[model samples]
Target: MKIIKLNAIDSTNSFLKEMGQNSTLKNFTVVVTNNQEKGRGQVENKWISKPFKNLTFSVFTKDFDLEIKDQKYLNFAISLAIFNTLSNYKTPNLSIKWPNDILSANKKICGILIENNIKGTKITSSIIGIGLNVNQEKFADSLKNATSLKNSTNSKYDYDLDDLLLEIIENLKNTIHLLSLKKYQELETGYLNVLYKKNIPSMFKDRNDVLFMGKIIGISLYGNLQVELEDEIVKEFGLKEISFA
Candidate 1:
């Protein structure tokens, strides 16, 4: 349960990955930064980090079955962890978007990126990178979809970075421990309940630039997104083949 707090770092996820690669790191070991120089999101999208204003951290976990491609559940796991942490602040508007984005009143409150190092069925480690807009006052023009807790509360949501990390790390540990016992059906159901694109037929941009107005069915074990086409055809796709509008 050790946390490596940094005044600044290139990327929390990158740092944690390197840490695992260098040695045998324990589960729940976390890397946190008040300032990140380069933060990457899904599809190589850049996460604009505002120093001391946002929460950027990553946790290393070795407690997962690593089966069931429903990697979406992992997203559910981490989102639940964050949700449990933030919900304690009396923020009832906080919610999670599908595929792994946290939102407060439809504006992005945080983003998650999951990475894993696998050797066959054995995963040496998994990195859960999270970026939460905790205290930022404003975002750049490009991040118009983002919001922060400070903005939501109209009061300073600032806290000691070390303390915040400890809270999130504990939530993460408990989450994984439960999942280790196959007790994630409830969280997974909760995540799907709040999906941003549930039952709505919307245009999605696939990896090859293909567009489809499909309704999401659910997620497969491998984390492949299951979408039901308008023509009543069911198609499942991996991460390379899907993203929200």
Candidate 2:
């Protein structure tokens, strides 16, 4: 539970990973920064946050000895942890967009990026980066789907970032404990229960840019999105292969 607070950093994930490479890092060690100069998202997307107006942090943990095939459960655990934490704040219409984005009323408020250190089919450690838009009211026009806690709740008072971070970390620790106990079914069920757009007919665009209609049935064991097509075929799509249209 060691927390390292920084004024600014290139990326909390990068900083923590580099630190781990050089020395032993206690489990649940966290590195949080007020300004993340080069924060990253899934698939190399940049995580944009106003300085000191958001929660930008990375957590280091090596508590789970998960195999490569069971790694998706870790994703499920982390996503559910954030989902549970935000629910406590009464985040309206909170749901988990597949693979760990936290959405409120279908607009994203939080994003998680997990980097696992693997060796011989086992994940030895994990560096999890989280970016949560807290009090920022304005976003670039380009980020039309982005929203913040202030915008979502219209709260006049700013959220205490430190308190929110600690709450999320506590939830994360509890969820990961379930994983360590191999409660895979419980974790997956919790994740699917809050999954966005589940069982609703929706449009998607594949990497080929071809549009199609499908319903998100569930997620594959390996963390792929399972969509039921019009032809009654259920297909699993990996990241970057399909996106909501």
Candidate 3:
């Protein structure tokens, strides 16, 4: 449970990786920054936050004993952990968008990027990077959908980043233990229970920008999204195959 705090860094994930390369880091080792110069998001998207106004950190965990085929469960567990943490803060209508985006009342509040190091067919380690909007009040026009904890709660609140970090790490510890204990069914079912837009018809766009309406059925074993369309047609879409419109 080694924690490293940085005044500023290019990317906490990269920093943690370099640290791991230079020396052995214990499980649950964390690197947090008050100012992340270049934060990353899912699928190479950029995560933007005002300096010292949000949460940006990465966690290094090892000995998952997880097969490469079941890596989605790791994502599920981490997502659930973040969701639980936010819910504990009384964030209203918390839901996880597929593949690790946390939404609050349909507005984006958090983003996660998980990179795994594999040895043979099993995962040897995972670098879980998280960027949670906490106190930022203004967002670029390009990120019109983004919102923060203070904005959502409509308060001039100042949060102690270390306190929130502690809470998140605790949640991750519990979830990771469950994962190692082979509580697959419980974690997977719990993930689906909080899945955003589940069983509700919503607009989605294919990579070609063609829009269609579908209801999210469930996630496939391979971590693809299963959607049932108007003609009773069901299909599974992986990352970048589909997105909310």
Candidate 4:
């Protein structure tokens, strides 16, 4: 539970990864920053956040004894943890957008990026990065779907980033414990229970930019999104292959 706080950093995930390679770090070691200069999301997508007005941090853990095939459970566990924590604050319509993004009222609020260190058939360690929009009130014109805790909740509530970070970390630790115990069914059920747009007809765009209608049924064992399309044909899509319309 070692926590390192920095005023600014290029990327918490990068910093922690370097530190872990050079020295032995305790499990659940965390690196948090008030200002992240080059934060990134899944697949090298840039993550932009207002300095001191959001939660941008990374957690380094080597406690999970997971096979390569069971890695998706980590995503399920972390997403559920953030979903559970935000639910306590009464974030309206909280749901986990597939793979790992937190949404409130259908607007993006948090993004998670997980980097796993693999050795042969097992995962040796993981660096989990989270960027949660908190008190920031405005977003760039291009980020029209982005929202923050302050904007999502009533104006009367004062959101503290430090408190929120600690709470999420605690929740994460508990959820991650479930993973270590191999409670795969429980974690998957929890994830699907609050999954966004589940069983509801929605539009999606594939990498080809072709639009289609489908319903998100469940995630595959390997973490691909399973969608039920026209004529009862169910398809599994990877992260880059599909996106919500």
Candidate 5:
């Protein structure tokens, strides 16, 4: 793995994507920054973190040859990798929110954004951007839902940043290997087992802003969320179609 460390940057994902376009970055090439300005998550959500207090990085993967139909497996694999890393740290209540957000005890601790390079119907490469709240203590009022490892655990983390980064990469390597071997069912099963709020009733808002209660059954093969609404009706909703209430 090639690692690039930056003191501050606009966005690690943007940097690595630009690099991937200009050069043949090796598989697992990582670009991490102490501070990320203008960092983004799914649906243009801004990720805010104090400089040098979190894990903000992007990784480039190449030549994976993943099928478009099974692309969500890649998302599950990456989420599982981060989940495993945090679980090792004894992070309380680690769970994967729908579409790959990492939560701890009902608070968000990590976000992942994956961009793929596709040729015809196969994914040739991917840029996996991750923003993990590590040691930050205070957050802006607008980020009330955000928490970090230090804040969640009530103890200071003295581990090196690269140590966690390398650990995630190692797990990612194993996941990618599974994808290469077409182990889709196994990966999906592992993902659902740790899925947040699965089989539990919760409140959600539909795209029209209507509030309703539903139970998460399982995600569809294409990664759409399946919710069993009142009256026992199950429906699938894609990204942006639903949000926690």
Candidate 6:
């Protein structure tokens, strides 16, 4: 794993994609930023942050030969890595929200955005971007739903940033390798156990912008949200279909 620490960037994913386009940047090449000026998330949602006060980076992965079923496990791996690292704070309350969000209590602590460059059913490469609210204290008015590690711990964690990142990368590497080997049952169990809204009747939006209440049955092998909705209709949702409340 190679880490490229940028002093500043519009978004680490964009930077890494630019790099991947030009060079033979192998899998696991990383582009990180102390401050991301214009970070983005799924559906082009803006990610706001205070400079140098959060964990923001992108991992460039070469996954050309991976089966489509194995691709979503990569998302699981990233969530697991963050969960494990945050566990060092002894906050067992940390959780993986369905479809790639990390939350503490009910507030967002991290967001994972997986973008792929694909040809047919195969992925040529993927940029897994993560923006974790690590050291921030105050959130903007619009981000009242956002919370940081400092908010969870009630005090700052005294840990080296580099060391924590190393831990995450190491876990991530092992996770992808494990999934590539097809040990998916283990991954699914761990992910479901830590899912934030798992088995809870909560609100989610459909493609029509209508809100409905459902319990998360767990994520599927293809990484869709398996939700048991009102009136007992069990539905599955991909990234484009279901949205969180």
Write the number of the candidate with greater TM-score, choosing between 4 and 6.
4
Residue pairs that clash (backbone atoms under 3 angstroms), model 5: none
Best TM-score among the predictions, by candidate number: 2
Q: Ranking under TM-score, best-scoring first?
A: 2, 4, 3, 5, 6, 1
- The C-alpha stretches of model 1 lying farther than 4 A from their native spots are 68-70, 156-160, 205-212
Cα lDDT tens digits for candidate 3, 121-228: 999999999999998899999999999888887766777778888999999998988889879888999899989999999999999999999999998888999999
Task: Candidate 4: list runs displaced more than 4 Å.
Answer: none
Model 4, 1-245: lDDT tens per residue? 99999999999999999998799999999999999999999898999999999999999988689999999999999999999999998889899999899999999999999999999999988999999999999899999999988888865666988899999999999999999999999999999999999999999999999999999999998999999998799999999999988
Clashing pairs in 6: none
> What local lDDT does model 2 show for residue 1?
98
* Residue lDDT tens for model 1, 1-245: 77788999889999988777689998788888889999989879888878987789888887687563545566777888888887776665777766787787778888889897777655556898888888788788988988877787677547565666678888887777766776768867877776666677989888778777898877776666788999989889776567765
Q: Could you estimate the TM-score for every candidate?
A: 0.87, 0.99, 0.97, 0.98, 0.97, 0.90
Where does candidate 6 stray beyond 4 Å? 156-158, 207-209, 243-245
Worst 10 residues of 4 by lDDT: 149-158
User: What would the per-residue lDDT of candidate 5 be over residues 1-245, giving only the tens digit for each residue?
Assistant: 89999999999999998987798899999999998988989989888878877899999987667989889999988999999899998999989999999999989999999999998999999999999998888888888888898887788555567788889999999888888888989989999999999999999999999999999999998889999998899999999999989
Model 2 segments more than 4 A misplaced: none
Q: In candidate 1, residue 214 scores what lDDT?
A: 94
- Worst 10-residue lDDT window for candidate 1 reads 66-75
Candidate 3 residue runs with Cα over 4 Å from true position: none
What does candidate 2's lDDT look like per residue over 7-36, in tens digits? 999999999999998999999999999999
For candidate 6, write residues 86-132 as lDDT tens digits. Answer: 88776537888877788888789888888887777766677889898
Which model is ahead, 1 or 6, in terms of lDDT? 6
| Cα lDDT for residue 145, candidate 6 | 90
Count clashing pairs, candidate 1: 6
